[model samples]
Target: MSSFCPNCPDQTIVDPPQTVYENYYHPQHVQVIHPVEIIRQHHCVPVYHHCVTYTVKDKMCTVSGLKKKSRKRK
Candidate 1:
């Protein structure tokens, strides 16, 4: 569910519940991914990727589930 501001059409996304696992990995070849939070700060979109933070403005703010692009071979 989202909450809309009266002065603007932008919606505020709510954060999900946090869960803790005692042991999420095994002895070998284990991988884990942390959840991310995204929201509109002023006029820009704040994206959190681990310890790094990025921003997207205007219409680009509407895009979701983005990842870094890889270069194509010539």
Candidate 2:
């Protein structure tokens, strides 16, 4: 049995440590599972807005439930 290192969990060393979770971290140890890109566009549906910014994945929604696939039959 052995304990993992806080700085190098995987026992890997990276130069010029990258910032992870707002802290300095090794590139090899830290991974960006979900990357969100900012996109600005005008939206009128649902609501009207001049400049609307949205994430690339749009995974920041607060509502919880299964996403609808298609409109229901009348």
Best by TM-score: 1
Per-candidate local distance difference test: 0.79, 0.74
Return the TM-score for candidate 2, rounded to 2 decimals: 0.14
The candidate scoring highest on lDDT is 1
Question: Candidate 2, clashing residue pairs?
Answer: none
12: Cα error in model 2, Å: 51
- Error (Å) of candidate 1 at residue 53 is 45
Q: Estimate, for each residue in 1-74, the C-alpha lDDT of model 1 and write its tens digit.
A: 77965685777898998998797755786688999999867776788777867997775464578887999999
lDDT of 2 at 67: 75
RMSD (CA, Å), each prediction: 48.8, 40.6
Off by over 4 Å in 1: 1-27, 43-74
